[model samples]
Target: MSLLTTLNDDIKTAMKAKDKETLSVLRMLKTAIQNEQIKAGRDLNGEEELTVLSREMKQRRDSLAEFEKAGRDDLADKAKIEITIVEKYMPEQLSEEEIRQIVQAAIDQTGASSAKEFGKVMGAVMPKVKGKAVGNQVNAIVKELLQEN
Candidate 1:
């Protein structure tokens, strides 16, 4: 089934199971996907839906970090729950070591020998790794590797 279809089905399942937290997160994801479709004046394709899922997941991670920093353990736990639910819809995440290797390959492929070409290298690499790795993580690894070279 398509991701959207699966999400809608899961929403019904969550409701039937009385899974309020999962249902809420699923509904939020549904809204985000619908909003994107409205904006584009067309329904989202699989790739576009994955983009929305990734964005939602990223927002939850950021929220979790802020909550932790403020010592709001309750809110942080809530954010973590939402993150876990949202992540169910995301492509499997690449590990740090795996991402670092891919980033290095991208750099080599782009012939980016210095930090000055960071932007160019990133542009080349982001598309290649898009659904597999989070942007900020990939960016940090790229920066560290580029700086070292």
Candidate 2:
């Protein structure tokens, strides 16, 4: 099913169950997806939908980090819950080892042997891993691998 359709169904379920936390997150996600559609002047395809979902998850993760760093346990706890809720809609994440392997392959494919070719390696890798991995983690692996080359 389309992400929007799935979100709508989940929203209804959350409402029926009086799941405020889940409902809130679902509403926010629905709104984000809708906004992107409006901006594009059309319905988003699966890849576009995944892009929006990834952005939302990244924002929540960044918020979680900041909250914890600031020692705001209550807010951090909420952010953590929000992250978990958002995660339910994401693709299964790639493990570090899987990501490393992908990055290594990209480097070989692109003939990228130094940090100077970061963009080249990343261009080759991102499309392969897309929603399955976080950019920062992929980036770090690429850098580590390239440095070793």
Candidate 3:
């Protein structure tokens, strides 16, 4: 099933089971997806859906960090649970080793030999790693590898 279809089914299930936390999260997810569709003036492809889901998860993580920083453990805990719920729809994350390998391949492919070519290497790598690895982590690995080369 498509992620949107799955989310819709889960929303109904949540409503039936009276899972308030999950229901709220699912509703918010549905809203986000719908908003993206409206903004684009078309339905999203699977990749676009993943992008929307990733953005939602990132927002939750930022909220979690800010909540913790303000010593609001109650809100932080809620954000953590919401993140867990959002993560259910994401593809399997790439491991550090896998990400590093991809970065190395991109560097070789682009002939990027220094930090100055970071943008070139990143352009080559980001498409392969998108929605699979953290952007900053992949950038760091690329910088480290380029500097060593």
Candidate 4:
């Protein structure tokens, strides 16, 4: 099933199971995804859905960090729970080793020899890594590889 369909089914399951926390998070996810679709002026493709899911997860992580910084462990814990719920829908995150392999391939493909061509190498790599690899992780790997080259 498509991610959207799975989400809808999961929402119903959460509701029926009386999983209040899961239901609330799922509802929020549904709302965010619908908002993204409206913004795009059409239904999102699978790739776009993954993009939205990634963005939501990133936002939760940032919020968790801010909450912890302010000494609000209660709020941070809630955000962490919400992040776990959100992550259920995300594709498997790439490991550092896997990400490095992809970056190396991109460098070879683009013939990128310096940090100055980071964007060029990134453009070549992103299509293959999107949704699987987080942006910061990919960028760090690319930078490290380029610096070593």
Find the candidate with the highest lDDT and give its number: 2
RMSD list, candidates in order: 1.2, 0.8, 1.2, 1.5
Candidate 1 regions exceeding 4 Å error are none
Better of 1 and 3 by lDDT: 3
Top-scoring candidate (TM-score): 2
| Ranked candidates (lDDT, high to low) | 2, 3, 4, 1
lDDT of 3 by residue, 1-149 (tens): 77789999999999999999999999999999999999999989999999998888888888998999999999999999998898888889999999989999998898888899999999999889878877878888998999999
lDDT for each residue of candidate 4 in 58-78, tens digit (9 for 90 to 100): 899889989999999999999
Model 3, CA-based lDDT: 0.91
Q: Write one digit per residue (lDDT tens) for candidate 2, span 1-149.
A: 89999999999999999999999999999999999999999999999999999999999999989999999999999999999999899999999999999999888888998899999999999999888998999989998999999
Better of 1 and 2 by lDDT: 2
Summed backbone clashes in each candidate are 0, 0, 0, 0
- Single out the weakest 10-residue window by summed lDDT for candidate 2: 105-114
Per-residue lDDT of candidate 1, residues 70-134 (tens digit): 99999999999998888778888889999988889988888998989999989988877777898
Off by over 4 Å in 2: none
User: How many angstroms is residue 14 displaced in model 1 relative to the true structure, after the best TM-score fit?
Assistant: 0.5
How far in Å is the alpha carbon of 135 misplaced in model 1?
1.9
